[model samples]
Target chain A: MSIFVDGNTTIVLQGATGSEGSFWAQHMIEMGARVVAAVTPGKEGQKLHGVPVFHSVRRAHAQHAAKAAMLFVPPRFARDAVLEALDAGIPRVVTIADGIPLHDQIQIRAAARAEGAQVVGGNTSGVISPGKSMVGMFPYWIERVYRPGSIGVMTRSGSLTNEVTAWVVDAGFGVSTLVGVGGDLVPGSRFAEFLPAFETDPETQAVVIVGELGGTMEEEVAEAIRDGVFTKPVVAFLGGRTAPSGKRMGHAGAIATGSSGTVAGKVKELEGAGALVADRPCRVGELLARVVQ
Target chain B: MRLLEYQGKAVFKEAGIMVPAARVVRASENQALRDEACAAARELMSAAGIGRQAEQDPTGSSGGETAWFAPGVMVKAQVTSGGRGKAGLIVRAESPEDAGQAAVAIVEREPSVRVILLEQMVDSACELYLSISTDAGSARHLILASAVGGVEIETLAEQNPTAIQRVSVDPFMGLQPYQTRGLGYDLGFSGELVKRFAQVTSSLYQVFRANDTELAEINPLFVTQDGSLIAGDSKLIIDDNSLNRQPQFEVTREQYGTDTEYEAALEGIPYVQFDGDISLMCAGAGLTTTVYDLVQFEGGTVANYLEFGGPNYRKARRAMELCLKNRSSVILIVTFGTIARADVMAEGIVGAIAELKPDRPIVTCIRGTNEEAATETLADAGIEPLLDTEEAVRRAVAIAKGEQV
Candidate 1:
């Protein structure tokens, strides 16, 4: 009920034979997500950790009904891997690679949308449903706070998810679901797509959107929130003003490319949209706490 | 990620795309660079303006390159990332001195004195932007083109997305020239420069594919008065993730200190460049970024990126001490998002500041984490740890501006 992925998602790995792919696959499995197939092109018919392997996604689709895909393929094969799964009818695809051309990303995004499918990232840590399912490597051992509750969390920063989740938990709250939409330039889903999911979820009473500088995404979300599609009280934070000058604020999409991408600009927009914009990331949970109370 | 127009020309040239004979300004000390640039500019100026220049400039120079710039030229900024023109990172100058002055200004705006990309300007009838990258869900390399190109491409796409057309490219078969030409046809690219622009787009996409690039763009792609097409100004953003596959680009990245930032980002520490009075020491990116914002919000400037480095109290405290040694109005430590023993670290910092000749006020608001021990110790050591980032930054700024904290 939280978002695109649910408890019943049977996911496959496109680059599952590689170390990164295997490591995150183990995490996804540990998080109780169904890890049904692994595809590595030539390493077909091979199984690692008891998961079946296939040469192509078409074979994997025939073997196991993979509803979602998490990709760890390098940039070179990223394009092929993405479409192969989509063409195979895997409706949800999440990639963790960064730097494939933007044109490819645009085409992929358009293609994905055309099929009523959702793609998560090209440079991301995957998605998570606190205490239920997680993709990519977020230390679940240290995170004991996601005990299943009403707050929905969305972050562009992959590594920051752990810290943000810990905050949500320590403040006597729990997250219904947390989605880490990749931080690369051409990530699959922007906040616009994730907002409706949070809005429709009965369990999600509020949302904590963690943003960075560099893109107009925060502004876009602010406009949407202002449009009144979402009724839940939204608490947001943009994490780049203190960004050591010259450093990228947490994500590729966070780059302050044009005027619309600055933290001040984002904060003003979010605030103007009636969002209780925290000046810093630390203020996110506390601000939500007051609103929820 | 930005590449100079010349860098785009290099990719186009490498892909067997026809561009003007060009010379990039790679060496600042070498006078031959200027000579080569001047020669290339003249050759290109005459070539692209072969038939048109006879009517525009009877004295024989085009794009206002005479006197101010190398005669018959266009001056461009050869930066490593995109949106330079929009960022005011590039300028079209009238003369070499004007171009040099603009380059100097660009370098001045930047922290370093690196070379700027300046090219021979072309006279054109139309402008466009052509680009290529990975299409994730489609799982194909993609080519995108817009007849309406420039810094305003994003706006154009938003206002009229249909005007921008795309083509899915298969990896194994590579990008077909026919596919690119078809995209041109769809975008209504039918003119003398159609084949040439199509070729450039194909070559640009090829270069993008060949280099394992994240993004390669040819903006302001000019269709000149003559039957020639020129890459007017370009911007390329390569994927730092694919640097290993693209060594040449990796080296250029190193020259501009992108490699250091890239490595630091991988290590889980966010780095930002700053010019300020203080060097911050804090745990986590959220805290650091917050402290930075609060500082700026409160009228305090920061220096270079300095992290508390770790969650360990001792290492973090030591890091705090090192940052305090710099000339800042105050040494502010703040943590949010899993403070992880930050209170103990704050205690150590207070203890260290007490033992040293501290000129700055030590302000911090460390929340989260169960640090009863650190809190008691810091209080006993006579240091008051502020609980709010805003207050900490406020007190720190007042202290730095010569007010009593």
Candidate 2:
């Protein structure tokens, strides 16, 4: 069984009439995810790819029992959209908007936490249980990189996730579940939230983390591994080693301002916690190959 | 989007927060700047209501006694970089003569310093620290207050961790009056002082929300002799995404000048400069960091970190121009386009190469989304694509080290 989404996951789509929303809705459908309902406030009663569109998450849930949601709303509208999703009792949501204000993210995370639900990202590419049910902007047309297997891949980078997954797929292993947690300063789901799920999933034999400099998320991953919350063999890679101090590298969260967010510091902590950390993305596959056996 | 001290203070004043009456002495290479500095010193004295005829007391024997500049004035170096006090850029000037000298000395030391701030120094009874910052771990805006102040908060967090009180504010409810009062009480304030402190805290939060500030801090919030609270120094960092709404705060990039930063701002590319040799370019921030780390891991240094979003070739070209202008030893292009099309990135690189025709070695790696088209485009431009990350990194390092391809 995959961690978050799988064959039986009935998903509701938010902002479904937008160009990006329409494209991904069709893509998810093509990947065999049951796109049960679509939510577009103004475009209700319309159909996208033969999928019925409702005006709100509540209206859509009334018609079809959608347990999970995928949000393609813009950054400005993301907070309201996610609140609507949580209000409708959708337990899991994946928000794909980037550049969402920090205050809005805090509210979204708080609301999700209060309801015992999970919001994947405000700047994320989304999550996939590969070959089962895919939600996000992940390029489903490139199927070889994401063939279902036993390795759980979670990363802060979207394209790098695909890059590392390509290496894993080429090395004769496939991703059981891959989650792009986003590179926002305050991503909705931290590595700690997903690591435990991978550890308990029977189909997943190993976990690969592609982390970056900035924030204490990587350090938290180390703490969890050290605390024995996650007992699975974990391989990790962190970027921004060559980054100069005090300069933000595009991502709002990728700047290393203090000792807690340094690459060298994170590497030492992760390695100290019994996780084999890779120096390069390709080496992650080699490390995972050795550990999984 | 980190504003200069003056810019930050301007936003603070707009929010009705109290700050020192100050004037900025703009830096210049000619007589205009010299004239400006003299005028700035006179302005500082007049703003403090201290006449030029006031006697200069050099000894500073009685700290409580009024000096030449009545309330006294502080000339602080306005560099974007922090730790100015430790850098010896901050000086207390009691006279116009001292203020003028201080500004000139600071400008001489820091070539990048465009302005010097001369503020009316307050005789504070106590220095308390207060800040509203977004803590990623908590996923919320946190209010941090401490009776201890005048030192870097990070330093305080390390040495006396218990001195700081951190409270998470719910964005839905905003920062409540009770929460503010609780923090004031935590800082050992009582009676009207606590209420006054809470008012300042509440106003700071409003400033943070109103201006879309990522960080709003009043280091050393002063408790004057009369028990009134005023912000001694303020820092407000506006969110880059929210800059469109803050047109008044937009000129800060030019005010806080850096060659690469100005160039990046002009090009609409997120570029950060370093003193390394190789120029590294990538599509996304995460992968750019990956390439950066790998380059350093392989014993190479990066000249700059440049990332392109979407299919914008103009940004790519401008990035290439910046690298060449910096005279990097080599240029390494790592493209793993997800939403960004590889073909578009390749076309941009090809366009850059055709126009610039750099003498330095150029190496590239491409993968995902239209890889064939990207490969064909690069090949047509007489450049081979290196798809392996490890191998490409090694080659880039070798070339950077002056090795022949």
Candidate 3:
């Protein structure tokens, strides 16, 4: 009933031999996430922490029938890795690796869109439908606290989500899904894409959206909120209150390129568009605590 | 990264696109800047086929012939950011003397003004947004055209997106003339207009793809004064990830916002320079936010939230000093994370404070995580660890108000 990765979804890990891929593969397995297959070119016939590894996504899928994928490959190889997933007819993919070239990113996004595949992040932390199943590497401490419930969680910063989730868990509400939709500017998925799934999911009654400065993704989501895509109560927080103007926090692509993408402006826009926006992350618990009931 | 106008022009030129007759003269410290301005003026006049007679003073009126040079002379400031026109960076000069004076004033008064783009301001018959980007989840090369042009293109599209017809070319095929022509028709074009739009779109796409562009925006894609299609105001954002393929284009550019830039500071940390601030420290966003949270909860106002990250007290002290430029009522520090160095972190803070003593209450919280045995470290420094972020904040606020923790 949760969004993104759920208990039954068989998953494959791309770039499984890489440091990040290996680290998360181990973490996800430890957190009780189903680690069905690992895909790396030369790591074929080997294993990552006892999970079988294959040379390509197709081979991995051939053996395990994996329906979802998480990419930890480098930017240059992201397109090929994603195309491999798409080629294998895997409908959903979550790419966590950063440093993708912008042109190749557009191509990857386009291919995913044309094929109707849900590509989570080209430079993203990946998604987690808590309690049901987990797909990517979110903090283990936070995961234990967050129970499955009606709240769908989304944040730009992967670490920030864990921090917010810690408070949410302590406050005694479970997360239906907690996703770090990749704070990188050129992400594979937008809030607009995640909305339909959140909208249809029966277990979800509310959403806590955490956004950062840079890009119109927040405004796009604000527009969707205005359009009545979700009828549930939504409490949102836009981080980077003290983030200097014009400097990107990290992920070279996430600079405030346009007028509307700044943090204060986003807060104004979200509140204007009917979102009960928290001024800072500190007030998130206070804001959400009131709304969910 | 904000590219200077000349650098942006260079990026455009590298893609083999036609720009105004111009060259950036680095004369911030030289009088030769005036001569460079004159040379730039002559180039503009020559390009427009307006030949001046020998020995004629460049500023002299050409028989007052209103149809003098192409359209008129444009003197623009070369800056790295967009909206220079809004900043009055670009101006139209009446004569060579005016252009030179403008350049000198701009150069000396503002070091940021490296050069001026002196050229014939051509009239636009129309404008279009001929760009290559990803739209609708597809890597697309789109030729967006409307009869109307200029900065209001977005508004025009929103009001009537249908009026602004698009020609989506495949990533491999790019923007073909036939595909562009189809878009020209959708935008109500026919006859010579169709060929003109198609040609410009095709050229722009070639430039866009070859240059490894993340975005190539020719806002108000010009229909030149000469009845030819050209790019007006090119805005290109190069993707850093692709720079490896085009090593020649590799330029070290990072956005260093003027916010809290104290030479010793790095660009992307949760750092802010506050006038009245505590030597506050915390890890992660949620824990860091507790400074503002617990303070306000206890009838206190925190100056701002600054995260030192991990459990390192060295970073915490630097952050605290940075926040304590004017100093807060008291210094309340909090550290609780998986990688706890509560002892070393507390010592660093105490060490920093001992060297820079001022009249203020210093409430420290070095107690959390792996600091139970580290009590000896705090005790050795004649300091005690506050139990939690709330107690420290409450105590700091109380000390500020002349009360007790």
Please give, as one word, the docking class of candidate 2.
Answer: medium
Model 2: per-residue Cα lDDT over B1-405, one tens digit each: 777787777776666666766788777763566566667767766755763434433322112122223345788877667788988788887777777777777777777777788887776788889999887665678899999988888788889999999989877778988899888888888998887788788889999998888889999888765456767787888787667666776644444457776867756677777878889887777888888888888999888877875434336677788788776888898877667878888888899888988878889897777888999999988998888877888999998888877
Q: For each model in turn, which proportion of the native inter-chain contacts is also found?
A: 0.19, 0.61, 0.23
Residue-level lDDT of model 3, residues A183-287, one tens digit each, is 555677777668878889888887888776667777877888889886677778765554545544444434554354576777777788777887644566777
Q: What is the interface RMSD of each candidate, in Å?
A: 6.1, 1.6, 6.2
**Candidate 2 structure quality by residue, lDDT tens digits, A1-293:** 99989879999999878776787788899888988999988888899899899989999999999989999898888989999999999999999887787777877888888899999997778988878888787776676677889999888987777777788888889989999999887788888899878888999998888898888888898899999999999899888776777778878888877555788889999999999988788888788888887
**What is the TM-score of model 2 when looking only at chain B?**
0.90
Q: Local distance difference test, per candidate?
A: 0.65, 0.81, 0.64
Per-prediction DockQ:
0.22, 0.65, 0.29
lDDT of 3 by residue, B1-405 (tens): 334555555665554455554545554554677777767766666555553322221322211111223434577666555566666767666566666766776666555565566766555556666666555334465556666666545566557666666667777556656777787787676788677666656666766777676666676666654445545566666665676776655343222223343222342345444444454556544345435545655666555446665323456456666556544667676654433355666666667767666466667665433456455666676776665455677678787677655
- Residue A276 alpha-carbon offset, candidate 3, angstroms: 3.0
Instruction: Give the TM-score (vs. native) of candidate 3.
Output: 0.75
What DockQ does candidate 1 have relative to the true complex? 0.22
* Model 2 spans with C-alpha error above 4 angstroms: B49-71, B310-314
TM-score order of candidates, top first: 2, 3, 1
Top TM-score hit: 2
lDDT of 2 at A205: 96
